[model samples]
Target: MKSVQKIMPDMRHFEPLPDMDDRQFQQWNALLESRTGSTLPLERKTFLVTNLGMRMREIGCRSYDEYFSMLEGMEGLREWNILVDRITVHETRFFRHPMSLDLVKEYVDSKPHDVDTGKISMQVWSVACSTGEEAYSLAMVVDQAFKKRGDESYFGVTATDISPASLNTGRKGIYSERRIKEMDASLRKEYFTPLSQGEYEINEYLRKRICFARMNVLDIDKEPVGKMDIIYCQNLLIYFERSSRHDIVKNMARHLLPGGLLILGSGELLNLDCPELEKINNLRVLAYRRVKEPNKDQN
Candidate 1:
C-alpha cells in the first residue's frame, strides 16, 4: 500500500477565546443591567465570561470588546435577545415553590361565594415565567380550586418573561419528564398529555387558558393587560439590584387589582413599603395584597 499522506484540518483557524478582563466584564455587566435590570456580581464573572464566550465564538468574535460593540444599537437587537435568553437563568419546574402554590390555592379558595355562577373572572399574572411550568401550575391550582368548590369561575393566567426563547417554550407547553416528575400524579394526568420520550404537553384547554408574552419586568408599567387578581413574581427579583427590585415590585403592584395578591420569592425583599400593598403575614411565603382604596365618604 502506498504511504498515505497525512491530512490534517487547519489549526490556525481555531484560536482560543480571549479572556474577559475586569473592565470588559464590568462593561458587559453595566450593559446587561441597563437593558435587563439584572446584575452580575463579581462572583458571576466566570458565568458571564462563559455565556459571552459561547455566543462570541458562534459569531466568530475575536474579543469581548468586539462582541460588546456588536450588541449595540438597533442592528444588534436580535442578537441581544439571543444573548438575554442564554445569560438569564431559566431553571424552573412545575410547582418549583410549593409554598407559593399553596398560597395561590388559598387565594383562589377565598374568592367570594356570592358571585354570579361562571361570571367570576379571575386574571393571574405569572411574571418571569420560565417555560410554562409556573403559569400552568397556577392554572391547575386555580382550576382545581374552582372545581372543588363546584364553581364555574373563569380564570386565566398571563405568563410573561424577558426571554423570547423562554416565552416560545411556554407557548409550546411541552416539558420533560423531569419537569413534571415531582408533580402530583393527578395534576400530571389531568393537565398533561404524555408524549414520546417521557415528555408531557399541557392539555389544549389549559394551554389555551394561558397567554404567554415576552415582557421585560422593567417595563411592566407599559403592560396593556388590565389589572390582575393575582401577580405571581418569584425567583426573579434576586437577580436584580435592590433599586431595580423595588421598582419592579412597585410597578407590578400598580397592575394588581385592589385586594389582589402580589407574591414574591421568600426573602427576595425586606420592608418593601408600597403604600398600596400590605404584606401577607405568612411565614412560608412572601406575599402582599393590594389595598383597596378607601371610599370618598370614609373618614
Candidate 2:
C-alpha cells in the first residue's frame, strides 16, 4: 500500500493563474514592441509571462504584478534589462551554426596579406554571444586560418551581451560534458581541456583572443568598438520592435566599415529604411554588405 501510494499522483493541487491579465498582456506587448520593433502574438505573450513569472520567483519576487511594478519605477530600467537578460534564452553552443563560420573564413582568406595596411586585419563582433562558446569558436577559426596563411597575427573577436551572470559564465569558459559533445571531434580536442568529471575548460589561447563586454543594443550613442569587418548579430533582433530594429540596424551599419558584412539570425530582415545595406543571397542566412559609398541620390 505504501509503495503504491508513492507511485500514484497526489490529487490535491491548486490551479495556476492565467499567465497575464489583459492589461499586463498589453503592457508586455508594448514593452516588447518598443524594444525590438517586433510584434508579439497572444500565445507568445502567455509563454513569456508564464516563463518570466517563474524566472522572477528565482529572484524572490512572488508574482508578475510585483515584478511589473518593480520594472515601472525610476530605477526599473536597469532591473528590466536584467530581467530580460535572465529570461531571454541563451540557446547557443560552440559552432552551433557552421555555415556562418565558413563565410567568415572565406572572407578572411580573400583579404590581402599586408600587415602594414591594417586593412588586411579583421575585426569581428559577436553580439549577444551567450556562454562565450560562439566567441571562442570564432577565435579558434581565425587563429587557425591566420596560422595556415603564415600570418603572424589573427583577427580579433568582441563578444557582447546584457547579462552579467551569463557574461561571467562565458568568461569562466567551463562547460558540462554534454555541451562539448556538439562540437566537432577535431575542435573538441583542440580547444578544450578536461577539467574534471563531466566538465571542460576552454583553451587559454582562444580565451585571450576574444574580449567580452556588457552592452545593451538599444543604447543610441553606442560608439563602435572599432571599425569592424564582420558583425554577427545572430538570434537577437527577433526580440525587438520595428523602430528598435531599425535603430539597431542603423547603428550596426554605422559601426561596419565600407564593404563589411552584417550577419543576422535566420528570421531577421533588413527594411527599406536601411538603404546603405544590400542583401546577398535569398537564403535564411541572409547576408548584408555595406555599400562602398552611400547613395546620395536615394534618401
Candidate 3:
C-alpha cells in the first residue's frame, strides 16, 4: 500500500470528514482529469476517499462538497499540488523493469560512432520519474554502455514529474540501502557514496548528468524541452483515459528525434498509430522507433 503523507491542521479539535458519495466522487474525478489528465476509476474509490479524508482533516473541512468547493479558482492551486503529491504513486526502484532497461542498453550499445564528433551524443527523458530512480537507472545504463565501448560519449537525462515533493527527493539523489539493494554491487560501489547512515548518495558524476523538473503531462507540448534520443514513460498512462493517453503519446512522439526510442510500460497502449514511428517487435517490451533521418548523400 502507498502511504499518504499527512498535512495536519493547526486546530486542536475537528470532526471526521464525511464519506464521499457517488456525486462527490464524480466531481473529484472530473477535476483530476481536467487538471492532470488522470482519471480515478470506480474501483479506486476507497483509495480516493482515504487520501482526500486526510487532506480534509488537515484543513478541518467537514464535508466533501465543502472541500471540493475550496478547490475552485486560483486560490486552490497550492492545495491541489499538495493533493497531487499525496495521491500519485511513487513506488519505484532502480531497474524496476529489467526488460525495458535492457532494451535501452541494447539501443545505446548498437549506435555507430559519430562521424563528426567521434562520440555518441544522446538525450534521454524520463517522464513521470517519481523520486528519481527511473531517471538514475537510465543514466546508469547509458553511461555503462559508453564505458564498455571505451568512448567518451556525451549524454544527459531530463527527469520530469508533477509533484514538487517527489522532485525535491530526486534532486537530493539520496536513497536508503534497501532502495539500492537489488542494484549490482559493482555499479552501486562505483556510482554511490556511503553516507553517515545506511543511506547512500548518488555520486556527483551521475547526479550532474540529470536535470529534474516539475511538469504536468497535460501541458507537455508547451514545455520547451527539445528532441530526445530516448523517452521513457512507464507506469503513467494507465491512470489516464484512453483518448488522453493517445494524445499524450502523440505529443511525446513529436519530442523524439529521428530514430529515437519511446518506451512505455508493457500493455499501457497497443496499436499506437503514429505515422512517424514503427512499433518495436518484442514480446517483453512496449516500445517504438521513430523513422530514421534520411541520409543526405544517398539522395
Candidate 4:
C-alpha cells in the first residue's frame, strides 16, 4: 500500500465570516423568538451575530440562510438544541443577588406560627436556574430560616432551565472558588463543603433537597413542577417582548399556590396588570402574591 499524507486546515487563508445584514438579522431574530419567546433587539444584533457565527463556524456553515434552512429541516431538532444553548444567557454566580435571597428569607420567617409546615412543606421554584447557584441558595436560606426558628418547617426547591447543559452542572453541585466568593462566609460554610483546592460542593443534605428538570419557559403549559409556594422567575422577562412578558408573569402566577410569592427582576414586570396577583413591596423589593380568586383571565 502507498503512504498518504493527511490534509490540514489552511490557517494562512483563514478569515472570519461577514456580519448579518438587516434582512438576514430578521431571519435569525424570528427563529430565536419562535423557539425561545425571546426578542433580540436591533441594538443587540451584533450579540446575535457573534453567538450564531461561533456555532456556524463549528458546523462549517458559510451563511445564515443555509444554517437556518438546516435548522428547519428534519434533523433540525438536534441542531436547534445546540444553537439555543449558545444563545441563552447563563452568566451567573453563587448567590448572584443577596438582596433577592433576603426577600425570600423574610417570607419564610413570616410563615404562620400555628401552621403545620411539616404536613405542608414550603416549595420554591427557581426558574432559569443556571448551574444551580440560585436554586441552591434558595434552599440554604429556607433551610436556615426554619432551623433558626426551631420549627418543624421543611422546604424543597425545584430548579428548572431550558438548557440541559446547565442542568447537568446543577446536578453535579460543584462550584469554583470565584463562584462562591460573593456568598456570605457563614452561609458558604454551612451549606457547602470544600471538595478540593478552590472548589466546593453543595452539602449532600442540601443537594438532596433540590430536583432538577429541563423546562422551556415558552412551554409554560407543560411545566414539570406543579404549584409552588414561591416562584423565582427573575432577570428573565427583560428578554421577552412586553406582551410576552405579561404572559410569562401570568403563567408564573398560575403556578403559585394561593398567597404564593412571585418574585421578578427589579423592573422586569413593572406595572403588570394581572388581577389574580397582588403586588407587594417588601423593603423596597417588589413581589407578587397569588390571590384566592384570580380573575381567571387567560393570557
Candidate 5:
C-alpha cells in the first residue's frame, strides 16, 4: 500500500467589525427597555457598542449587524437578559459610598421600639444590589450596630437585583481579596474567612441574614414585598427616563411604611409635582424621607 501524507486545512484570519449605526443603537436600546425596564443613555449606548460588540465577536459573530440580527430572532427571555447583563454596569465594592451607609446607620439608630408590639424591627431593601456587596455591607452594618445595642435580632435586610447570575454570586458569599480591601480590618476578620490566594468567603451568619431575590423594579408588585422602613434604590434611577423614574418613586413610596426613608441615587431627585415624598436637606449625601400620614380628622 502507498503511504499517504495527512493534509491540513488553512485557517482564515479575522478582522474587527464595524460599529453600530445610530438606528441600530436605537433599536438595541428599545429592545433593552422592553426586556429590562431600563433606558440606555447616549454614553451607555457607546459603551454597549464598544464593549458588547467585542463580546459579540468573541461569541463568533462577525459584526454588530449579524449579532443584532441573531438577537432579534431569539425567542426566549434569557438571551435578552444576557444582553442586558452585558451592557449593565455592575461596578460595586464592599462598603461603597460610605455616606449612604451612614444614612442607613442613622435611620436604624433612630428607630423606636413598639410599645404595644414589643421590640420593633426594621426592613431594608437594597434595590439593584449587584454581586451582593452592597447588601452584605448593609447587613454587616445593621448587624454590628444592633449587636452593640444588644438588639441583634431586631433588623433584617432584603437584597434584590435583576440579574440572577449576579444574585447567585452574591448568595455564594465568596469574594476575591481586592473586593474586600475597603472593608474594615476588624470587620473582615469577623465576617470573612481567608481562602487560598487572597480570597475570602463571607460568613454564613451574615449571608443568612439577607434574603436575595431576583426582581425587576418596574414590574414588582408592591403587595408581596410588604412595607419597608428604608429603601436604598441608589444608582438605579439614572438608567430610567423621567416618567419611569417618577413611576418607580411612586411605587416605592407606596411600599414604604409611614415615616420611612427613600434613598435615591446621588444624581436623582423627586419631581416638584410629586407630593408624596419630602427631601431631607443639610445632608452630605442625597436622601429623602416619606411624609407621615395625614391626620384622619384633617382628611
Candidate 6:
C-alpha cells in the first residue's frame, strides 16, 4: 500500500496559466496564418499558448482574450513582429546540411569557366538565411570552387529572412565558438577571424560578399530579385500549409535564371507539379531546376 503522504499530491508546483478556449485559439491561428502563412493545429495550441503567455506577461495582459484584442490593427502589427520572434523557430548553423552543399558544388563545377568576357558571374540567394551562416557557407564553397577552377571573382550571396533580429545578427557576421564548432576546421580558419572576446567574425573576403535583408514570404512576388543562378530555400516551408508551400516555391521559381537550380529542404514537398520546375533526382539528392524562363507576359 502506498503511504498516505505520497498518495496526496503536493500543492506547491501546480500553478497553471489561464486556459485558452476554442474561439481564442481560432483567432490566434487565423492571425498567424494571415501574417506568416503558418497555422498551429489544435494539438499544438498548448505550445502557442505558452509562448503567448510569456509575451502577455511582459506586456501586462491579464487574459488571453485581452491579448487577442491587443493583436488587432496598425499598432498590433508591431506586436506581431515581437510575437513572431518569440514563436517562430530559427535554428540553423554553418553547412547545416552537407549533402545540399555538395550538390551545389557539383553544379558550380559544371558551370562554364569565367573567361573575363564580362559575363555575369554566379548569383546565389540563401532564402531565410538565419544568422548569416548559410550565406557565408555558400560564399566559402563558391570561393573555394572558383579558386580551384583558377577563377578569381568571388560571387555575392543575397540572404533574406522574415525576422529582422535574425537579419541583424547575419549582417554583423560575428558568431560564438559554440555556434561554429561543427564547421570544418580548415574552413573555419580560412574564413573567420577570432576576436579577443572569444567570438569569431567572418573574414572580410566572405563578409563583404553577402547582403542581408528582411523579407516575408507573402511579399516575395512584389520583390524583383531577378535571375539567381542558385536559390537555396531550405528548412523554412515546413512551417506553412501545403498549399502555401506550393505557392512559395512557385514564386521562388519565377526569380530563377533559365535552367538555374532551386534547392529545398529534403522531402519538403513531394510530387511537386509546378509547370516551370523540373525535379532532379540525383544520388539521394532532391532538387529542382527551372525548365525555362516564364514568358514576360505570363506570371
Top lDDT hit:
3
lDDT of 2 by residue, 1-299 (tens): 55554565432223344457788778877775565345567767656866676566556665667777788856897777667664566888878778878877777777675556554577889988977888887787777777777865557889998777788888999999898897778878988899878899988878877888888777634655777888888777876755677678888887787778888877675553787788867464767888888564132
Looking at model 3, residue 278 earns an lDDT score of 90
- The sequence of per-residue lDDT tens digits that candidate 6 reaches over residues 198-280 is 79999988888899987888888999786788999888988888988999999998888777899999878877888888988
For all predictions, the C-alpha RMSD in Å is 3.4, 5.4, 5.8, 3.7, 4.3, 7.2
Off by over 4 Å in 2: 1-19, 32-39, 115-120, 270-273, 282-284, 294-299
For model 6, what is the alpha-carbon lDDT of residue 66? 74
- In candidate 1, position 181 carries an lDDT of 88
Rank all candidate structures by their TM-score, best first, as comma-separated numbers: 1, 3, 4, 6, 5, 2
- Clashing residue pairs in candidate 2 (N, C-alpha, C atoms within 3 angstroms): 36-240, 36-241, 37-240, 37-241, 37-242, 38-240, 38-241
Clashing pairs in 6: none
Candidate 1: pairs in clash = none
Output the better candidate (2/4) by lDDT: 4
Q: Residue 187: error of model 1 in Å? A: 1.0
Of the candidates numbered 1 and 2, which has the greater lDDT value? Answer: 1
> Candidate 4, which segments miss by more than 4 Å at Cα?
1-14, 113-120, 294-299
Q: Candidate 3, clashing residue pairs?
A: none
lDDT of 5 by residue, 1-299 (tens): 99999876422214556767888888888877876778777766778777676566556666666666666644646555676667777888888778888888888787888777767688888989988998898888877777766753467788888888788889999999888887799999999999999889998888878999988897765438977888988778887777888888878877778788887778676553456678878456777787887662132
- Number of backbone collisions per candidate: 0, 7, 0, 0, 0, 0
Model 3 residue 154 lDDT? 90
Task: State the lDDT at 72 in candidate 2.
Answer: 80
Ranked by TM-score, the better of candidates 2 and 4 is 4
Q: What does candidate 4's lDDT look like per residue over 52-152, in tens digits? A: 88888887787888888998866898888777878888877766677888888888888775443344368999999977888998898899888877877
